[model samples]
Target: MKSLPPLGDDAVVRLSRQGGVAAIHTLTRPREIAFAQCNIDQRTRICSVLEGCLAIEDPASGRGDQRFYEIEVCYRIGEQDDRMVMKVPEDRAPGELVHLWDKGEVL
Candidate 1:
C-alpha cells in the first residue's frame, strides 16, 4: 500500500500529471482533510472539507515523468467531485508524513 504523509489542513498538494476521473480505488481520506470535526464518508469517493479551499493541481507541469497524479484536495462544505481529470506529482512522496498539521492549528 503506497501512502504519502498526511497533509495539513491548509497545506496545498500539487500533482505531477493529469489524472483519470475514473476515481481511484480509494479516494482521499476525509480524516486527512479536516482537523477534528465533520469528516466525509470514506466510501463516498468525494472530497470533503472542514476549512480552507480545495484544488487539484499538476505538480509535474515543469517536472518529469508526467504520469503520476495526486488528489490535491483543499476544503469545502458541499458535495463536489473533480469531473475534470485530476493531476498528481511524480517525485517520490514523503515518508510517514501523515498528520501534517497539528489539528486546529492553521497550517
Candidate 2:
C-alpha cells in the first residue's frame, strides 16, 4: 500500500488523466476507476470510464447534506452484469441510481 495525497476528487481525476488507475478500499467497500482516454464534464460531474460513463451529483434537494450523492450509470459495458452495478452500498442510495440500457440489457 502507498500513501495518497488528500486532493479528493480532483486528485482522482488528475491521476486518471495521467494514465494511472486508482483502487480505493474503505471499511465499507472497494472501488476502482480507470479514466484513460475518456471524456469528463466537470460541471455535470460525469466521467467516462472503462466502457461507460458515470454521473455523480449532489442533489439540490439535499442541500446541507454532505453525505448525499446521486450516481447514475448511463450505460452498460460489454456484457457487464447487473449484479456488479447493484453492489453499491444501500446507504449510498443505490435505488436512486438510474441505469440506462445498453445492447438490450439494463445497466
Candidate 3:
C-alpha cells in the first residue's frame, strides 16, 4: 500500500467546496449548468469526504451527448499511502471484487 496522509478538515472542506468544482470543469469543459452535491461525510470530524454528481458531455463511444457522473474526494491525515478508489459493478457478486492495482505496481 502507499502512504495515505489524512488532511485537516479545513483543507479538505475548502477543496471540496471550491477546488473540486473548478477541477471538474477544467477536466470536462462541461456546458454551464448547476452542479449538485450528492453526499457529504464529516462524521469522523477529522476530514471531509464529498461525493458530487454533474452532467457532462459523454465521451464514451456510441453514447449520448450528456450523462451524469459522480466524483468522490477523500483526504486522510497520516503518513501512509493506502488510498484507493474502487468501482463496484452492480451486476457482480460481492465477493467478486478485485483490486485493479496494488501500491508500487506498474500502471
How high is the lDDT of residue 72 in model 1?
50
Q: Tell me how candidate 3 scores on lDDT.
A: 0.24
Clashing pairs in 2: none
For candidate 1, write residues 39-102 as lDDT tens digits: 3342121233211112323434424423343445443334432222233332432221122221
TM agreement with the true structure for every prediction:
0.24, 0.19, 0.22
Give the Å error, residue 1, model 2: 29
| Superposed model 1: Cα runs more than 4 Å off | 1-32, 37-69, 75-88, 97-107
lDDT of each: 0.31, 0.25, 0.24
Q: Best candidate, TM-score-wise?
A: 1
Per residue, candidate 3 scores C-alpha lDDT tens digits across 26-67 of 443222111122122322321212211111212241223222
Off by over 4 Å in 2: 1-10, 13-29, 41-43, 47-89, 92-107
Q: Using TM-score as the measure, name the better of candidate 1 and candidate 3.
A: 1
**Which structure is stronger by lDDT: 1 or 2?**
1
